[model samples]
Target: MYERARYWFDNTLARGVTALIGWLAVACLAVVIPVSALLVWTDERAPDTAWAKTAAVWRSVGQTLRLGGEVGSPLRVILSVLLALMALFYVSTIVGLITTAITEELIALRRGHSTVLESGHTVLLGWSDQIFTVVAELVAANANQPRSAIAILADRDVTEMEEELRSEVGDTGRTRVICRNGRPTDPAALTRVSPATADVVLVLPRDHPQEDAEIVKNLLALRTAVDDSRVRTVAVVRDAHCRLAAELAAGPDAVVLEIDDVTARLVAQCVRQPGLSVVYQELLDFAGDEFYVVDAPDQAGRVFAEVLRACPTSSVVGVAGMDGTLRLNPPATSVLSQGDRLVVIAQDDDTTVTTHEPAAFDESVMANRPPAAARPERVLLLGWNRRARHIVRHLSGHVAAGSVLHVVAHGSESLAAEVRAAAQAAPALTVTFGPGDPTLPGTVNEVDLSAHDGVIVLGPDHGPGQASPDDRTLVTLLLLRDRERTSGVPVRVVTEMTDDRNRVLAPAGAGADFIVSGKLVGLLMAQISQNWHLAALFGELLAPQGNAIHLKPAGDYVRPGHRASFATIVEAASRRGECALGYRTRGIARAGNDHEVRINPAKAEVRYWGADDEVIVMAER
Candidate 1:
């Protein structure tokens, strides 16, 4: 009965009840006057004396005022009329608002663009920084289809959602975004966005502890709401151990992306190649060229070098097979089957070619030399974070044996031991934990960073309610630069930045590279949002299997008086079985100038040669 009453209230009575109630109120008022007059006449004829009659008239006048009039005399009658008019005005305004809302909803329904209490659309559960990124990607992915809609259901104000979208992502193009205000975990609230007809559901982890558990609960609710096995469901989980629980809750076909593993991998890559996160940025962002599947002509058992030279339009980075297996920059001699497709970097399908060279590199000019001599190392790890362990682990991989890692921080007991164990496990790196304020005096000097070859500052975690990490990073950079000027030591500093806002804060002369964590996640979601295969491609690049970004010595590509050309560098790197994509120059001595790390270098710059240019190379493992 309650359900039926609600249905009637929503469907039928909700529209016309206001007007009916207004008319009924008017009728009640119209009948009250006659009834009051009859009663007063009857009372006066039956028993009232002069004083009693006067008291009875006053009583009737008071009753009239209470009903809708003024308190005294004939002016009360005018007051009553005025009160009725005011009530009518209020009723009209309320009725108009309800009517407008209902009308808008009806029109939207008729156009098949919206629905109430759930219907066909992709429902994004929860709210976080990843929400905007998720929406933008979903829109772009479904852009080619006609009238594909995305419903965002979160425990946030719908108007705030709209405003955030406009400010962050302008012109959603052809995709329509509908915001539903409610908790995503509640079944009734979830119904507001219609989960039954949803093509896919993405349950994002909240930015809090027990986020993994929250995802599991949301998944369980989603399963109950939609029994359809065909609907693709994806969730984000914080811990590796929780991944199994989330996957079990989401079922076999559903994907539960483990946040820690992905983040760790990114941090590891950044440690190896300081600006690798930028590659992810350009690939994931909509403004630049993205990864693509371009068909390379029958290489006829040719080498990867020849195949790379063969692809004219797109920049070939990897290849995908019919069996869904992928290989990044597979060896030149690796046979290409007819079913295999080359993965290239291009803006779109139309912007690519099958067989052509990306400006020829003169082979004669290519110079291959022995590796540079090792220098004594001083490394400073400023601050502490979740990724700090992973960074230390990967950093230990490349350094010479017996190299010292000075960890300077207001050390936490839990993280301190973890860092110590990780570094001890590494064969080459010797770990030392020290207590010092990153933004304080005598802290950097006490560590003797002047003797250090490089310093790495780990950004703070965005976990739970932690303070913003950017300011600490900026202060550390400032302190380092001030000390470097006094000491005159060229200490290579690589730092982690949590927010993009702090990018300009560090002086370029601080001799450091910055890694923005949130931006990396944003870029990842953006890529997978547009093309599903990109997730796999990104995984391959980030993984330790092949052609990872490496910083090779400058002597491998250019000499002291050589005319600079990207083609020459590419040829040199190719001779070493690597792809030379870009370089970071050691030429910028003054702080705050361009750090001179160009990823996709222009082919025509003749005066850009430098002996200290670190070649960005991609090679088979």
Candidate 2:
């Protein structure tokens, strides 16, 4: 019985520690009021001390029994001890409640439950490996701003996200990154990040099978919460088929990017013309030159061709019509109307200015060399992955009618079926498949490496539930380099890697065009996040059905061994219905090195042209 009473007392005391404020108040009063009553009743100096002694004793006893307090006699002393113990218990309980409340608040903060109160901030919705790149780019873009903030909303712990960002992105000068934990598709969760007042909202596609659908849902939720028409939202969709649906859900103004289509088009373009990827990186990445739209009112009545020569530091590639139409590489005769913006490529937006004094064009150096004729060639593909199908589809459209393609990879009949379907869609190109492990040197030697005009190494599947897909790709590249060295055959190699870090480890002297898929996607996402309108510009540039970046032989614009000014070359390309941005010299196709390919060069500068040198242009063909 005694042990049971002790257990009950301990449990009751623990319950009291976590009790509500009202219960604690009751406990305090139960000790204080009773103690006061007992002290008053036990007073020896009574009105009728002699006769009322017995009555006072009885009243004190009743009060002491009802409430724990001090009284006269031995019974009163025992009650006093009990009352002191009760008071101590009440104090401990209050302290425990306060401590518990503080601990819970800290836990909530760590969990990213708090609301973010920031204005004119960039809101990034979702978390993935791409967040680091996005954050780093934003930091660089906002370097001149006095203060900048990037609020992130993802279903992750705040501390973890912050730590990872700090580890990856390092220092972010004046930009502050705020993390909030919540489901991106939830309206209430979206509200916590203050999406309505945000300058831009970037929705990163999750790495999952249903990423496209999830992106659509997140866009819809963000749209519903951010009623402000000024708020710009950009999202990435993995599948091209889901782009229209995502765009519809995100509203007419929202920017949606198709990852597979963009990557596939880039691969196709890069394979045909080496070092073209570097040109794109220069225009897309924040570290280098980027595209900007600025009002050129002074040159309102000037022709597009004249505007190209007017900007000595900036390359005037296109014009954005006043009616919200973006025309890249328009005809030279097309006039820039009032209120129309010029699409320029420059180191910074401030550098895209028009010079009143135009550079002198050397008409003596201009030559009319005809464009090269299309020729059928043989191509080899090493390994296959998710992007293999899209690459084949885009390849068929770019290659000549009778071009042949050979795909070699270690796969069952399912992959062969898919490749066959891709081939059927593009009847102009013939594709054949062979089963072999592309990573092994012996397997790669079975094919005639010298016979193929170009070799494309596709990034292989890492493994079941594996992350790094570039390991096998690197091995294949090494073996290919060995084979080429042994056979003394020179072939244009364009390899795809999943991670950007692995690009640096590629075999030296291989002269392969390394296409880092994630890095490219991240750059595109970052560019779109900064300026939502650029999404339309990028969509048109990367799409297979629109005007894309091309490397035409310089001979088409000027005669070989002739010295010509850039202004004359620009005029020559304009005559051919193409916009010339810069030129890529022969025997210089280094990746990430912009010295060989000069973009937005000075119009007055003269250079000797070669027949093999190519002029970078934006055209349909």
Candidate 3:
């Protein structure tokens, strides 16, 4: 009873203060009404006591009422004012209710309970075009597991993200999607995606350069924040140097993929042979013949090539021996022993037991081929860029002693020290520096094309405010083509290209081969969209593990006017302990087409026996 009385007293005091102010206003009006009635009654009096006093009082009251005249219409004005105040009170209450509700929802979002999903979900961190591809693949991978969830963490509105996923990813087969709004770089923000409960954590590259390094930094934050190492981590790195850094950041169990270097290697292979990307697509794609690892029965007398023909929808491309030797296209008639695991290619693992012919062999012709030319003795580097050092480092292992590599570029003064350092470990690769404009005169003349056995054109390094690399390459090719008019000496050329669309700018007559990096990146993206396991398979192939792609003598595979089919070439490679899939045929005039080389018979239709023509093969000792 006391508490209720106190509440009533406080409320009455507040209202009493308001009412007192209202009463003061009303009392002022009482003087005005009486003064007006007196003025009407005393219209006849002038200077008498009653008349003067009445006039004085009337004047004073008139002045007072004029000064404070918000009083005469008391009842109507008070009612109207009360109604206006009540309307304002109701409007304020409605606005307060709406604001409180919105704040509660926002708080719920930050706490993560509003959208936190269950365990066993796949968590994706960061944002990019790669994200769309990754989610599509995850959806496909989760087709067998019902109720699988995919959660994405990005600094974007959740609804906007969901809309994009729906439009770009289409139907996510048996996978539910959850989006959380947060920055990936922040550890606390990462908690919204529930990284500890996730099955796989895919760290994506940022949308710009230095993306891999940024991702590595984010991984470090995640390691400290994500408390669980059992979760498999897969990350895409943009640079080769960052691969080790990312591995360390993501820990030993994490799989850090260096996509740029892999893309460059693929570009190099496709340049060596047209349609090579198509072959890789067929091998790596889920919709086509995929790579599989199957154990073959112990046969002490069987051959590796013959074992390849023994699988269904599967081709034996390689063999893993008991001693861990990975031999691809191993020697024909070479006896396969027990514990040899055949590295076969098939549509899937289920098609590894069908039988087929290994190859039709004629031993006399295979035994008579001569050895390949000595290691590239003199080489020419046509430009300066980041990839130039990598190429030089790789060449160090292959080039023999007494090999000289000349460096020709405008920035030799600045880049000479770096080039010298790269060649420091390789004493055989001596550096000779020359200063000349890549787009101007007297550059190709300085480095005699006829003297060097090989010429490697380094594409322009991408930097702020720099011209396109393709334009510079086209100018260099034109100059080289002009210089080779008199000297018919063979100079094998390999060029780096920044853009695939600009590859057609190079002159076809220069006898130069080119590597288009963009197309290789596109092809990789296309392949991974269908299958995820291919990432590791191609990584092992490009690495120096076992049988890598090598250029071989054309006569070792096929002869001039032999009318040999692709099958015959594959057979010859089987005999030579190499797996041949394609070749560079000479004598074909490459007329206006940039994609294929036309091998015209009349001009130079000899057996493609040159150091320049790289026969696509898997090499084995």
- Clash count, candidate 1: 13
lDDT of 1 by residue, 519-597 (tens): 5555565555445566677666666465566677667776745666665676566666666556677657444533455
Better of 1 and 2 by lDDT: 2
In lDDT terms, how accurate is model 2? 0.81
**Could you tell which candidate, 1 or 3, scores higher by TM-score?**
1
| TM-scores, all models, native as reference | 0.73, 0.83, 0.62
Give the C-alpha miss distance for residue 317 in model 3, angstroms. Answer: 2.5
**Per-residue lDDT over 415-525 for candidate 3, one digit per residue giving the tens place of the 0 to 100 score:** 878777868866657877777776675777767777776676766776656777778888887777676765665456667776655667676353456665544443444
Q: What's the CA error at residue 191 for candidate 1, in Å?
A: 5.6
Q: List the residue pairs that clash in candidate 2.
A: none
RMSD of each: 10.6, 8.0, 13.8
lDDT: which candidate is best? 2
Superposition error at 498 for model 1 (Å): 3.1
After best superposition, candidate 2 residue 3: deviation in angstroms?
Answer: 28
Please give the clash total of every predicted structure, in order: 13, 0, 9
Predictions in order: lDDT: 0.66, 0.81, 0.62
Q: Candidate 2 regions off by >4 Å?
A: 1-95, 227-230, 461-464, 508-510, 586-595, 608-612
